[model samples]
Target: MKTIKHFLIALMSIAAFTACEKDGDLITLSGLEQSELMATESTVVLTQETSAEHALSLTWTTSTLTVSDPTMLAPNVLSTTLQVSASEDFSGTIQESVESSLSHTYTVAQLNTIAKNLGATPDAATPVYFRLEASVGANMNPVYSNMITVNITTYEIDMSIGFILNSDQEATGATLYSADSDGEYVGFMGATAWYSFFLEEGDGTVWGNDAVSGTAFVTSSEDGSWNCWFPGQGGCYYVDFNTNSQNWSALWIPTLTVSGDISGELTFDRPNVKWTLPFTATSTTMTIQVSGTGNQYNNATGTDDEAAIDTPVAFAQNGSYVELVSQAGDITVTVPQAGDYTLTIDLSDPTAWTVEAVEGSEEPVVVNPNVYLPGVDDGISGNWTFDNALPLYNEENLAYAGVVNVNSLWGYTINIERDNWSDNYLLDSGDATSGTLVFQGNTNIPAPTAGLYLIDVSLNGLTYNLTALGNEIWVVGLDDQWNFNMPLTATATAGEYSGQITFAGASPWGFQIHLDSSWNRYFGGSSGSLHYRGSNITDDASLTAGTYTMTVNLIAGTYSITQ
Candidate 1:
């Protein structure tokens, strides 16, 4: 009886297993199907003028999702999204917006801005591609639609007409000067909305005026708020203003003409003959003596006084008018007495230039001999003070020369006044030491690298040069016991060194060339041609055990090893 009961239970278990298999088969046949989205339009065109009114629309069919269990009937929420991309592959500049309804619409302006934000040019028409995506429940499969292409035209602001400068003194449209696009017009102290004044007509006139105590010109709206105006009877002008710094300059359209005489007899000419006036920091007045053997003056004629009578002469003159040759007025100078006479010019007022005769002296102007290396980082801690500064003496070459141990790199300016940083000499182009130096507004000179170097500077010529100095050269390798102490000495010849060494070590042995028993300055490489402070030879040469001659050109910074 117990066995019969057990057989009945087994039979019941088999029946239950058959029912489960049949249910699984039904579920597989009725599995959930993924739905796809479709777009209403394949291509779209948009214009910048009416971008807000135009839009690209996309629509898609709803998707149906199913569950494995037939008894579990839960509602599935479908979420749809519209995506835009610059490329068909959707790899670059992609934007997506969630769709609440079956269709999504994007304004023309919105699409154009999106394209620009994704790296499209502002003024050009861009091709934009769009696609739709449909997603069911978190566990259900998502679907994608066919891609659509849209062409968007974007417009750029006309910067030429954005800002204009017009004065009440000038007729409407008669003298309307537009503002220049001189970068973003950053105003005084971070001010904004200030544009630079430019000329719309008549030689592109602009105004230049003092920012402080300058006249202000109002635009069309005279509501008490006005733009800065150019002082002095307004013709055509260019007004340059810095709203952030509150600094402004207004100059007449046509620059003022300035011409002067050298001895009440010589008249100045534009672009041809002009005296290059020299001035010192402390002197409120400047004097140029054009007598025999004095501060010589030249005219259209050559430097020779007798030759300069009828011919044009070129005189070195320095002032604000160096580039204003076209606008300066004719200036004349007359030399009454041929004897040594000094033409003293007053610098108090630029408008009224006066020259008077003074007694001339033949004494040579004495320049300070001691030169200090100011504004230099000497591998030490300090600011631009002269304390602990490097001093250079007048060498035989008439230039200040000295040897200095500098940091890996440094920048410095030269100065004759030991305590004054203002009276310093700097390079014409900042950080350029290859050219001549200037007394004012010069840039810092750079040191190529850290090492002992000989620095030579000529205050008179305003030029400088630097040379790296090395005391000794050594060749070390396995044959030299890999010790710097046991190295071959190089014989110096014409700024170069050459040495020969015998290598009896293993066929492939590493070797290097060092300077002064130190590795700081060394050269080693696979190529026969060497580089200063370059990498070492990783691949050892399989030279037969023999004597090899090595030559190093210190001045040229090259080396070679030959068997």
Candidate 2:
């Protein structure tokens, strides 16, 4: 009863362990939510002057701060015509109660001063306006603040015309003339100048079209201000002059040429060129054909005027990967791999060509590979032996009757044995004349001649003759105490041998009887052993005694003999 109780407890403990192992896990919670903010718009503006008593300060903030103030910015007349000073915190002359929110009112004096500077009169006909605009955060956000345009009679003058383009100037000696100040261009060959004149009608101003002739500088009087004038029905005008000649000099911009390394003694027909500006080349074959014109190019600044002409040429060889440039000929190159690779050029043809890695190159080049097979027999780029011996071959049928195909018969369960392995070597029976297994070694030993040889044995310390040309002999009834040393020999002798039979001990004595043909023979003796070497060649050949010539077939069977 106690043993049963113990077993029950063990079973319960096993069940508990299994339950704990299978139920060891807890629920896990995981997840996340994300929200994105858009980029804001960046803005720029120019102030009329730094004369306002209530100095304005521009404040900006962003999640990623990388913005610069006006004071820290460089002046680029080409990119921006207006210059803006740094913002100030001081508010001057404005009413004390006007400070609130993002904007404040200016005094009448400030407004008049600003207007005069902007070339605008205080009257309604030439009223000035206070312009207000907002900029995006420094994070390059796509969002923008509301734009404010307030037209007030009391306004500050804006000295900046905000003209981004420069006017063309014609000069002759000390005199310089500009087409923009002329109000209207003299008009192209068949063009005309026209304007919309303001007409007094009703309470507001009305306009009507008017055509005028002459080169007098006239602006659009429709708004009573110096606004640019338009010519023709479409209000587009162009300057036309028939001067003898106008010399405009431009700088020559250099183009870069890029190309991949090419291999072999080949030529790259077409190449390409790339420049900082668009250019049209003199030839269509030249890539990146585009033209660039500007005053910055007048003195041929930078690498202008210099052009690059590069093409891919190759002289591929065994070890070298080469690419040629059309401009510069024949440069040695090395590629990572052998197969198809590309040549990248800056100016010349950007495309690449397919190349093959071959052997026998004109130049001596070496390839350093990470991994390579050592001492191989197959042909490749590594060190492989070429003088190794080939499989053995036999010319004459020596072992079998008649002409023996040594290669076939020698391979037929043939083996060689030697007491000392110091001169060990394999005899290729296939290379023999009469299926004679040739012995070879690293030492200076004479190679065995190819011929038919019969394996013989001397019984009782005497050379015995085979019953047939290729027969095996075995002696029976020899005393174990006889001192007969067994000597196995191979010869072409044809005769039976008999002599004093001797043995060392009780150890059984035996000799191998090999046959040249496919036959079966048998042998058994009292108190002795018969070990036949040839396969199925021992059949007690029961060969009758007589001077008869017969084919000693390998298969075992007795037959009558005649002489």
Give the candidate number with the greatest lDDT. 1
The Cα RMSD in angstroms, rounded to one decimal, for candidate 2 relative to the true structure is 43.9
- The predictions' CA RMSDs to the true structure, in order, are 24.4, 43.9
lDDT of all the models against the reference? Answer: 0.44, 0.23
Error of 2 at 280 (Å): 7.7
Model 1 bad stretches (over 4 Å):
1-43, 68-72, 122-125, 137-141, 157-563
Give candidate 2 misplaced runs (Cα > 4 Å). 1-114, 118-563
Q: Pick out the ten consecutive residues of candidate 1 with the lowest summed lDDT.
A: 186-195
How good is model 2 by TM-score? 0.13
